[model samples]
Target: MSSSSLTVQGLAKRYGEFVALAPTSLDVPAGEFLTLLGPSGSGKTTLLSLIAGLASPDEGAVRIGGADVTYRPPYERDLGMVFQNYALFPHMTIEDNIAFPLKMRKVGTAEAKARAAEALEMVRLPHVAKRFPRELSGGQQQRIALARCLVYRPSIILMDEPLGALDKKLREQMQLEIKRIHRELATTIIYVTHDQEEAMTMSDRICLMNAGQIEQLGAPGDLYFRPRTVFVADFLGESNLLPARVTAATGDTLDITLAGDAGTAQAIASGAVLAAGAQVTVMVRPQNVVVRSAVEGSGKLKGKLADVMVTGSLTKLYLDALAPGLPQLVAAYPTRSLSDEHRIGDLLELDWQAADAVAIADAKGH
Candidate 1:
């Protein structure tokens, strides 16, 4: 199968005065897996609906393969959509459900049967073709939904939290299966999810949205390692946001002093614009912060260990606030590397490489 490209220009949707989406624009290249990620009420679903022709955009245009499809209906758009619920007809056999789309398009019985069989084989559910939806497990039912979508060979696929109902193990298993299908078919997929780990694991790029705006768009690593805004940093993963006063700025690097810790650290400025004496936020990932015993060369901050939480592979250590009116600093260390003798109330030092932190324009809260 060949891949299809999609583009949206200034897409906007509204229900009277309640704007569901606002002036959103995106260009999805052929054969790419793009995920629209956000919290609830962030317009991700509205954007997906607009693109799939389920909802009309009040402004801007939607194009598929360079042809205008802004006013096309869902069926006419030739795109497959998988919703959170499996949406399979409980009364129909799996084979019939898979062939329903082909039937709607007036495909011959023989050809439709052949295509439905192929779709079931593609999803590794050929054995369940004769079973009803109620007779199958949730994972199997979801596979049937996927087969139904593939039977018609749609140009693009839009998924709306398709695995949200499954348990953790099943969700992870489906993530790999969907990724494999995308690779084998070279299909352009636009996926929507509120799960950060799912988005990071499945997509070639992530479009992070907040309050009807695209906060940041980049590869998973880029969004995690080099967040351009405070919201992106906090939303993407766990980060230690330290308030700092910029003492000096040179090119793309800034020398800043931590407000409460009374320590200096150099961080790469996210954008081109930077001025001296500006209050910036220093974003340090929890894993990057090293918790170590006092050593001759390591930078040390005198703080008592406030709490420790051990989960599977890592131990999260919370340190007492070093500065007045500051939140407790947190650091995560691999469980294997942690010393067994350490306990709460033990004084420890935290240090990290200057280059590991990111400097961004200060915002109210994360």
Candidate 2:
């Protein structure tokens, strides 16, 4: 299938007095895989619906491959959309389900059947053509749904949580299948999901939404490692956010005093140009938080172990900060890294480098 570039300019939506999506603009290069990621009611699906012409926007326009399709109908937009549920015909065979799209556009029967087989082969499921939807597993049914979408040869495909209904293993397996299909077809794809790990695995870029607005948009690693905001930091992964008073702002570093009796911390500034004595938040990922004991170097933070939970390969340690009223924080290490000396009730110090920690505007909570 030929790929297409997608552009959304000033796109927005509203339901009576409530704003469903704020004005947003984005550009997706041809053949790129972009994911819209957020929690429920975050407008990711609403934006996808608007782009697919399922719902009309209150403002703004959408263009596919340089053609303005904002006012066009869903079918005229030439885009294929897959939903959470595999919407397949129960009575029809899998081959017919895949060919239905081609038949809708009035392709000849023989050619439609041939294209359906090709689509199935693209998904690595060429043998299930004659089986009914009930005869196949959930993952197989989802693959048939995708084959149905691919049979139409649309330049753009929009998927809204296509694998959300499957079990964990199946979902992960489908994620890899989707990525492979993208590689082979090279079509412009816009995917919507609330799963952060799924987005990270399949997307070329992630547009993280929040409260009808785009919070942060970037590659997966950039968004995770260098979050632009506190919400971006806490929402994408586990984080320990500490309120700190900025004592010195020099060059690329911001020296800050931790809240309560916690000592100083240094973190990289995020272009906000924090002023002296300004209040900011320190964001350190759990893996980045170093737990040190009496044999430590530059730890300064003193806390008692409140709990330890071991699951699989990782062990999580929750600390009750002895640094006055500072918030309780957590650190994680590989289970094999934990020693007998690191027990509950043991005093520990938290340490991390300025380069590893992030500084963002203060927020009360996620």
Candidate 3:
């Protein structure tokens, strides 16, 4: 259960002329949880398949625990895999299904049964071992599928959206369960999912892919707080992008004039390079922008509240800039912060700290 380090160099895959994955390179540390996150047709699954030995890479090499496994077949690779569909055998009892992998490896019946029982218990499904897949609920069946993969005690586990079939509450519960299992087993896990929140909550690091290429790879907080590319900023979470021109540059901080309705807002350069007079995009999170009734100080722009959408925990206020050329903006405030005096169409000043604002090159395209 200890061997979990994986490394890929220039991995590429193709189906005829259409490339499934480009030259992708990534390193996953042992006993760490790494998630491949992207939208559909973004090569997340293809990368997982390449790692699992289900599909061959046309270029590059795959190494597990410092050993080359690029050309190895799935069986020879000795990795456990859980698919989105669960892939349980309906005809077999849960116990037997969990024992199948051990049987394939030629383990004795008594030993296989003991291991199967332990695996079932690991996933909290010991009582359902005698039941058939058809008799179990979707979540229970998925647990069985997990048990089957765990019985062999493979060092590396590849899960392809394993909880995608479950309902929202069940999916959240399973996310915690899987994270706990990863911590307890200390196995190297490569998970694939299109859900950003799921990846952010469970993974130690996330590899975001786009159009057969790796867009960015980093810790969830790093990706969220300091994105390198425009696509990463837009895809990972909600952002209010305002056009700006750099007025001054002092080291990492920059004084910029915001374009459109909101007259001018100061921002700091979050990226590696920035020069004075450069056109940039000011990246501001909704939570970072503050809404106030009175203009307390400078760097505040007046805006009219266009709409307010109240969710249980927070309220989202859409504002139209009072200035002629400024763009409309959205701000999210905690429910507790709302006062009885505020109403729709009221004028409010929107302001944000320079440090909270991220400035990126304007030429970077999506």
Candidate 4:
């Protein structure tokens, strides 16, 4: 199947007084899997609707493979869409359901049958070709829906919460299956979901939206490790956001004094320019935090161990920061690395490497 590049230039949408999407521009290379991810009302679905031609944009252009498709209808966009409900005909056989799109396109009977079978094989559900949709499990039905979409070989595929209805295990299984098919076909896909983990697992790049606008756009690691805004940091994953005042800039690192008497620490600024007196938030991932009875030097955050949880391979420690006005901090470690020393009510020292922490300006705090 041939893939096509997608470009949205200055796309904007509004519902009377409320803005559904701000002026947004993005370039998706052919075969790149990009996810529109965010919380509800963050414009992810709105963006997907506009791209699929289900809704018209108030302003902007949509181009597929460099061709202007702003005014084109959904049918002419050459895109396939998969929904959470697995929109398959209940009465039709799985093979006939997969071939339905080809029938509409007036493909030859033998060719459609062969392509339908091939699509079923791609999704690893060829054995159920003769079964009705009701006879298959939820996961198998979803695979059949995907096969139906692929039988016609649309240039782009848009999936909106395709696995939202499945259980955790089944959802994970479907994620891998869809990724496998994507890898095999190299088709351009624009997926929309509120699940950060799902986006991280499946997307080549993620476009995070918030408050009807794009908050960040980058690889999962880039958004997780080096977020440009506090919302991105807090929304993407668990983070320890410490309020601090910048004390000085030391090369690429910045010396910051934590709020209250939490002492001072150095953090990599990651190119954020700030003055000495600038208020900022230092973000540290829980996995990067080191918990020990004693940290060698000063600048350690002392806290009482509020709780400890051992979950299979990982042990989580919750600590109440000794500093006034500071929120509780959480630290995660490998279960094998911890002994019986961690207990509730015990005072522990928390520390992390300067490189593992990021100092972000607090002006845009959420």
Q: Please report the candidate that would top TM-score against the real structure.
A: 4
For model 4, the stretches where C-alpha displacement exceeds 4 angstroms are 294-297, 337-339, 364-366
What is the C-alpha lDDT profile of model 2 across 1-366, one tens digit per residue?
999999999999999999999999999999999999999999999999999888999899999999999999999988998888998999999999999988889999999999999999998889999999999999999999999999999999999999999999999999999999999889999999999999999999999999999999999998998888888888998889888888888886988888884877789876477777777888898888888884444537778998988877888889998777577889988888534557889988888989998888665422
Global lDDT of each candidate: 0.87, 0.89, 0.86, 0.91
Candidate maximizing lDDT: 4
lDDT, candidate 1, equals: 0.87
Where does candidate 2 clash, by residue pair? none
A best-first ranking of the candidates according to their lDDT comes to 4, 2, 1, 3
Q: Distance from true position, residue 137, model 2, in Å?
A: 0.7
Clashes of 1: 0
Over the stretch 266-351, how does candidate 3's per-residue lDDT look in tens digits? 77776667887788888888999888895645556778888888887877888887657656788887877544456888889878
Error of 1 at 177 (Å): 0.5
Clashing pairs in 1: none
lDDT of 3 at 150: 90
Lowest summed lDDT across 10 adjacent residues in model 1 is found at 294-303
Q: What is the C-alpha RMSD of each candidate to the true structure, in Å?
A: 2.2, 2.1, 2.1, 1.7
